[model samples]
Target chain A: MNPTSLAPSELAYVPFVSVDNMMKNVSAIGVETVMKGIADYIEEDFLRWESFDKKPRIPAHAPQGVIELMPTSDGKTFGFKYVNGHPDNIKDGRQTVTGFGVLSDLSTGYPLLFTEMTILTALRTAANSALAAKYLAPKSSKTMAIIGNGAQSDFQCLAFKTMLGITEIRAYDIDPDASVRLARNLATSGLNVTICKTAEDAIEGAQIITTVTADKKCATILTDNMVGPGVHINAVGGDCPGKTELHKDILLRSDIFVEFPDQTHIEGEFQQLPRDHPVTELWQVYAGQAAGRTSEHQITLFDSVGFAIEDFSALRYVRDMLPKTGYFEKLDLLADPDDPRDLFGMVLRAEAGRNGEAA
Target chain B: MNPTSLAPSELAYVPFVSVDNMMKNVSAIGVETVMKGIADYIEEDFLRWESFDKKPRIPAHAPQGVIELMPTSDGKTFGFKYVNGHPDNIKDGRQTVTGFGVLSDLSTGYPLLFTEMTILTALRTAANSALAAKYLAPKSSKTMAIIGNGAQSDFQCLAFKTMLGITEIRAYDIDPDASVRLARNLATSGLNVTICKTAEDAIEGAQIITTVTADKKCATILTDNMVGPGVHINAVGGDCPGKTELHKDILLRSDIFVEFPDQTHIEGEFQQLPRDHPVTELWQVYAGQAAGRTSEHQITLFDSVGFAIEDFSALRYVRDMLPKTGYFEKLDLLADPDDPRDLFGMVLRAEAGRNGEAA
Candidate 1:
């Protein structure tokens, strides 16, 4: 038997989407428009939450980092994301987070699409945050303080602008350059970006505050002292087991909302809370079975750790939009034949046919 | 934000490979060559199993079928499979098992490559069988009886021919058409194919017996009465829990070998054995730390429930090979920029730069 290492030249061609194309596509569609569409999709799927077979992410934790597979299917379309979180990745000249996913049909079990999901993840994560904010934030809310200006902060700003008509974004990161970078990136997005000196400055006077800092520790990016009444806190960074951003006291005071309680209990700010913590599954609010932010003066917190169903919506959108935008290439993945059973016959015939055609 | 509902026109431009391309690639190099190469990849990774963050599959069981994500990653490369099992899929004009996967660098957490793992799975599963067989079967093994000739049968024959120098394949399937199809597919693969009327006839005097059925039920493809001394049983069909191929009596009589004891215990023929069946991990044998096929007359059973590491090896090979094969197209999925943190800058600038240039 020949070892694959001995035969390294036999590779298969796969279409890829670089970040440049993602940005180009996002920019053309206008960040505002994309966010609105993504929020709609997320909202619509949340309404059909029961139709989905959902599970908490399966993570493989190694020394350097953790890789996870997040999957969900609603008996119609199935989607899953393979994402890795490596905090040390940036030091190696790489993003700390990257991902890609596949979408398939349940009727035939054939994969209908393949996509670069890294950028899509950021977009969808932001979209999900904004959608949660739409339901949980005060109706007249406009100002947002974004804590953490890494890969995801810009999307959070963009999503808010498109989904909620948010025009002002106050940004803060421990690293001054990140806040500066966030402001510079938003320079053209048309949103008023403010560089704040402290997390308190970012969240002060803001109706919706978003925490998306990346760290492996229980760092307090926002304290109860920094939060105000009727503030919708979108906590996006405390996703994994030990990584958290909020002061536990803040969560105790806020009426918290979550995507999936089972997941949020494990991955969201709720992880720090008791197993029986009083958190509402946000799907109910979308379904009208539960109340969102009951009053303009009440505080609401959306513990946004990202979910597989949101990826389902985003992947579906990307797959649908690629054709209209003419930005993607189909990958030769599923074997198609007049006879699916002739899998081997196809191979033999392909070999034989290749020879015959060559002759 | 828009939901993706792609028609063929939307995907017509995606990079595609006809079955002919895969055949030519395999034939120009040979199927055996591919199987052996994948085995080396699988073995090399297995030796460092502790380095991987491994997870049992996350399965979504529907009334008629099951969808699954099998994910694994070393600190360097992350990989996962989106696969489903529907024994009834063929009746619905679909293969029972279909899958695809991605390989990404952990440092940057970037998905470097993606490929259809359906056909690659068939190749890898078969390669896995042959790999285990090489470690368990006698060097003089020349014939393999493959009972249950469904979609995966052809690869089984190919793997044996390429890995163990198998010159003769005696095939049998309850559906005679499946057997006929298997024989016909392998007619030109340089291995002598024989159509047998019964499982007993196919297994008679053959040194290797492989079962690749698609039935979800625990049907005994091989019984205790049919067993012979010194033969190796490559059980492929009895993968899921409650699905068994070799009868308990046969397993009791044979020395069982497994890839991952934790998984194979639940999904492989080991399920038929006690919780402590005392099976040898195949890697220990490959590492020369354990005995393999201890004697000439020993009956060995390599109960393989496909593992993620095999897919990892196959996916890595395809990623490395596609570029050299000239069968790839670049997909703009990753949001790569001059500065990774300036993600939002990417799309905004592209849009503005393009608008300015057009003016």
Candidate 2:
């Protein structure tokens, strides 16, 4: 009746990347390089978009903010990000958006990586924005106007500079100090930074304009007259219902591109448009199944609501780099019994260990 | 232009309860006491279930198994459990189900605790079953027939003994070795145990029959003729679609009670019946809005598909016990920047720390 016990501590360990380690990894790899690596993974996943099981985020909404679970799988690997968006959190010295995520093996249903996604999310969001700009922006694009100089602004600037050879950065925020902070942070990024007093000034002669203002209500950061021809607008902050940055007129005039229509139609700038409005899936452009930016004068809008696949790609990238970077610690997250059916015996053994009976 | 830096490292740390600590906590509090505590919390939450934002689990199904996220919030607090069910995993020295959970402060969108839920789930599930039986079973019921002698078997045995004063257990498993192990694990407990050769033999004189076999198919673990009147069937095995442990004829005869009918209809034994089949919500019974057991001869079935509210209650219980037990470690899982807008600067600070300059 007594089953022989076996060691299972190793099976219980799951690699965990903490904020300190994530920052060290990013710093060691160089923020721009890590972002590029993540972007490449994203592009690779996007090219095989059909392989993924995608779903709209499951959200629990409250008065102060929203908490959401974004899960996606590529049949072999499963990944999900737990994120919370609270605009007023800044008053308490917390980021407006904070998150963490897990990546697991589909075959075993065991977690491969548990990591902080607050920094990773910022990086991946920028990488995704720049990736879309690469496909939708004019080939000669160089200057990028960043209309939101907040937590995500600097990442967007660096991603565009690294991914698209962007040389000029025009930054503007409702709070002028945010622009100043953005300029100072990118001082060593080698991009020419200019702080603008107005959104219009920030977009002057800019081929790519990224609007990432954080507000819970619909606000026009960019209007029809403000957006000219051949401009790729990356709208990143209209991520929840009743919250958007670009004017409805701009969306009507631009050729809209979205990550997942099922989601974007509810949370992105596309929410302003009718349900049946014509829009292109960005993965189609990555797969070369659909055209992107056919005319020089045609406006293109990347409704950057951020998707689950992008987080999955970022998680995969972090997991792949762990062996080389050694920036993660092993966590005893799963209970691995010697015999899976004898879980009760494991508890008994732990009790024995506690009582100095097991040696 | 440089924003003043503030201390935020403290804010980055979240309390994490590992598997080792979970076992220690369970052993320290005694398994039966922990189950009773979790059962009390389950009952308290069920009484006010209308306040919770309830949703069916978000599941990602694959060939090998399924991974799911069960999330719920009471407006002030948010909780979720990440669990996977892979029946074949046991063959590889892995559990059929393993889980971890997070409890967050919804007001701030910050996680209050992250803990291993594999053991906690076992305890909570058993407590939930016993609590349901307390409301549905005959007042004088003292014997429980457990058909599955697997990982969850011991917990169920202890829970019934602690919660309902059940003094005798009749255990049976397809694998005789499993039955032997179950008997060995509960040998120290003061409950009378009998190892049975057949499922029919196990339920011979038992007033409450619990079926918790692990199979991914439509299994006829119990037949209509086998179950006598006045018996409370605690069906806990068949949770996913296309999985049923009991026969359809037995289902038609018993008064079914379920947690979240929307989910039970798809995952519980109710999946076998028509969409409009009558069933009572278990929470309604807790809130005194519906009947549980009307007469001694009335057969009641607690279709335990497992719901988010139960997991939320378990998480709440664990978080409350952390300070007293001190069985947790701090995990730096969130990015806390000095200035909320200066997340990039936080990275720069980390870069400085990596370069041996920050100090």
Candidate 3:
């Protein structure tokens, strides 16, 4: 079927990026390059954060997990991500996180792009971590510690290497096989990788500490003694309510930075702190309206809960690259009749056409 | 590609109903039959409305139109519809209202179905109107006066005819062509269709009056002097802020029934009345908890703003029928890998395989 043969009204097509196509797109553009591109978009969006209409994600909490819709708009375009977090899914051979996103024109309320966001989410989460580290981490930092070397650890390593010029990664996981898997994945990459036995050993001489454990609980992966002066903490795993990765004493000793303070306080490690605690908005820091690292000795922490704006940025980046990559399929996701008011007639004509064809 | 060949982890296919398929489905089942089926589902849901979580839709109002997310859950399953209402879109040959919905498993947060709801919304909206009219309209009513003959007119005419045995329809539109188009569509449907020049002519000797205008304003399609006793008013079009079809005096004189009182108070004809005004919950009437049309002289009005539960029921009906009808396509909307944690490795392996194939 030639899509161009159809009338404009009948050609309501949305570009969709499936998992296979997403992998193809990632391979087409090297993973590190894609990570850097996502970081650039994240930084660009963060620099103009006030232009976005930000709100706390709308979550439907169930017995086993939660489904959330995170939406943000920049007056011209609208984007939303439908993501689910079910830690128990892994036991059933499913990923703990699965996501898809839609980018739409605000004027028409029509979706322009629909894409699988599992890969994109991992890429953007790591990009966000490295973007924050660029502003908050100790300058010229070389070695970094990844406490939970799961699905996100490899992305974090590559993002930091590409975006922040970090060359060495010391990775540790509760499951030793996961650390081994992480190291194996980075074998071909130029960055040096070390598989550590314990979290203390992982963070021994590292200037950046990334904790990305998956348990949906308040477990302390980092303590006040583990985190030293001038070290940057990229807290990625303790996102939902009742989940924290760092001790309260460490949060009190560091200068906290967050995407949106209102959301971070509920979902990030900041959830452990008081609601009135001082935390600079990451956008403010990126825009130079607030300080990121005031002194070399001041410890800076990015309490990353992941926000809607980051998803919006990732979607925008993917949409901009679709034309060049052609790694997308058009989906017939909208109903458009020749006469907008003749919706019933459209159905009736289809019936008549089918009857004719069958006869 | 045989979907079953993939591991269960990679067999994440979601059934999608596109516009063409939706029209075919409508044709295969017959429009009125589908409307009746949806009405049955709506009645079943309404009878147990308390078991469902009901919240006002979350709306983002822009200068051109409004986008809304309406979500509801009945403990076991969750459903939400993404809908947009832009009245001016008709001028640009686009739909005034376009919608799509997602139904997901609450336990795992995996989407079970995604379907185009522009046509479904029209079907369900008309079904909801007719369902309410069954309880509120005068018994053995034979004719309905439809004041607006836009996209929703033909469905309303057919729904009342199918559900309430109303074989005659007096349809009038501000644009004469719209009324003519509606009449032409219903020519072979076995109903006596009349194209009226004015609203007064349309309602002449009619027992039921339905106003479904599309203007996003508080324009009175029916005034105090126009409606008489025992006339059941199915107000269909006015469903947003600053939009209503009936005058305040008409509402004051009528016994009002609504889907959800909180939403109807703001978006329905009751928006003209004070907050303290008494209104019967339609679900209560359906459940035998409240009265509906107690007197022959009483003016009965169904003030509907379209609730989320109705959309949920429609989606449920479609999902139940997909297996029997085979009227959907499987979409690869989720990312699944052999080892869910080794997402990056999966992409890397795909790259290597592609390179090997090329060589």
Candidate 4:
């Protein structure tokens, strides 16, 4: 049993997209184009919600932050993301939320792709925000107030502009430097960007409000007095237990739509509301089974705790686009033996080959 | 925001051991030595079992196979293994089980090691069995009858020989070629091996019996008639629901010890017993809180469905051995921006760097 004599099939190689390749991929495909493509996939999957096996992200909480595993399957493929949120990671020069994901074939349970999702997560979060706005926001809306101008702000602005024809963004962050950074990044993004001094100033007269603050506490980034009628609030920041961005009064008045109620009740802005409070599943709205923004005076809120299915869709998109973009390296992730039952023999043969090579 | 200007700290590179490197590592350390080392770690972790956060492996079952995530933490570090069980994968030249794992810092939730676990899992599963046998098996046991001599058989033989001083093995498998394969692989080892044609013949004069057959059904590999007094049984293969290797009568007569009752009741041979059936936690036995092998005439069974804590210990062992073995590659798995909040800007700068290099 020589290792050199053992041959593995193509399934042994998993396409891996690193940060550099992911950047190149975004640049080659155009950020807005990729965002739109992912949004379309999200929409299609949402329409067939019954096909997906959905569960709340499994969290392991420590003193500093939380690490999570979000897994989902569509009977044909399985996908899961390993993500962590440590707001204080910035002090140590690490992203507040870093992620990686794997997609595998259901028939064989072999991983097809392994990828860095720090950037893809930002993209999918934005695409999901805009997709929600398309259904819940007031028609003819052209202005959005981004309250947290951080890593996610620029993508949120572009996604709205690309997916829903929003051309104006009023952005503000507690950290003025973050606002400046967002404004500079979006200077060429074809959106009229205004860096406001305060969240109140940013939300003034805007039809959509997106809050993506980074604190791990239940701080109110948006008050009830600041939100106006017919405005859609995309609450993206408060995504863990004891973390909420909007005041409870706002949730009490708005028609809350959520990705998954079981998860949203624990990690989303909806955590501030009562457990049995009325909320609509966003998939129902996307599928035309439920109403979204039914009245002009209704305040619509999408308590967007990101879901596993969105990561699944994003992975599928990247896997399908790999042939065209060529932005992946093959990784020898799985062990393949010539005879599946001879795994021990394979290792023994490999040992023999190494010794032979050394000799 | 230039990619060339952004500096990531030393934490950005994760030590990744691929299949090739893992093979080299096993050869470098010697299989029996690594097995003994992992068994030692498993025993140490079991002593402080209350310190770990344990959960049943999260499974996504399709019509053909199942994919699972098994995670555990000790308040300081978090470890998880992504594994799949596809019995029919052999038809496609793939192992019945393949796995990969991550070990991360609990303080920052950043992964420190990413390694292929197909080989590590084989080693750990065998080490776990041998470790349990040390407590439950009759004293001076020197021979083991291994009933399913496929992928796991060689490792089981070596682990027992290394950890429990077993010097002889009688192997039998439904597929006789698998038994021949196991015997062939272990030929050069110091232990004496005998290939038996039937399960009944294999158990003769053996003090321990290990059943690891790979059928996805409740087919009995060992019955009441096959059992002898004072012999310990290590049940390995029946790991999921609807899979069991021992007859109910055999289970009724044995003093069962399990890693975690909640999981074993669903996946192990205990699945055949009643819900309120009495069993001892192996940790209690190891920690001396409960009794193990109290009499020479008692039949003891270690119902060994794998647990997350074992994988955690295995990961910890591998991470510690990396500096000595140097059988790993550094993976650029995380996206580290100069400003942690500027993930998009990092990608944008990388794009700019690519364009600048081209120019």
lDDT of 4: 0.91
Which numbered prediction scores highest in lDDT against the true structure?
2
Task: Say which docking band candidate 4 falls in.
Answer: high
lDDT of 2 by residue, B201-237 (tens): 9999999999999989999999999999999999999
Better of 2 and 3 by DockQ: 2
Q: What does DockQ come to for candidate 2?
A: 0.80
Q: Candidate 1's residue-wise lDDT over A1-359, tens digit each?
A: 12222121112223334455556667667676777788788888989989998878877666678778788888777788778787886664556776777777665566666666777888888989888888889887789999889889988998888788888898889899999888887787779988988888887678889899889888888878878788889999999888889989999999999888888887878988898988889899999999998887788999988889999998778767666676655455555443556666656655555566567
State the lDDT of candidate 1 residue by residue for B41-102, as single tens digits: 88888788778776788876666777788777876777877787877776655567766666
Task: Name the DockQ score for candidate 3.
Answer: 0.71
Model 3 Cα lDDT, one tens digit per residue, B4-39: 334224346788998878887888888999999999
**Fnat for each model:** 0.51, 0.79, 0.62, 0.78
CAPRI category for model 1: acceptable
Clashing pairs in 2: none
Q: Looking at candidate 1, what is the lDDT of residue A259?
A: 82
The 10 consecutive residues of candidate 1 chain A with the worst lDDT sum are A1-10
Report the lDDT of model 3 for residue B225.
Answer: 95
Looking at model 2, residue B303 earns an lDDT score of 93
DockQ of each: 0.38, 0.80, 0.71, 0.82
Better of 1 and 4 by TM-score: 4
lDDT of 2 at A150: 91
i-RMS for every candidate (Å) is 3.9, 0.9, 1.2, 0.9
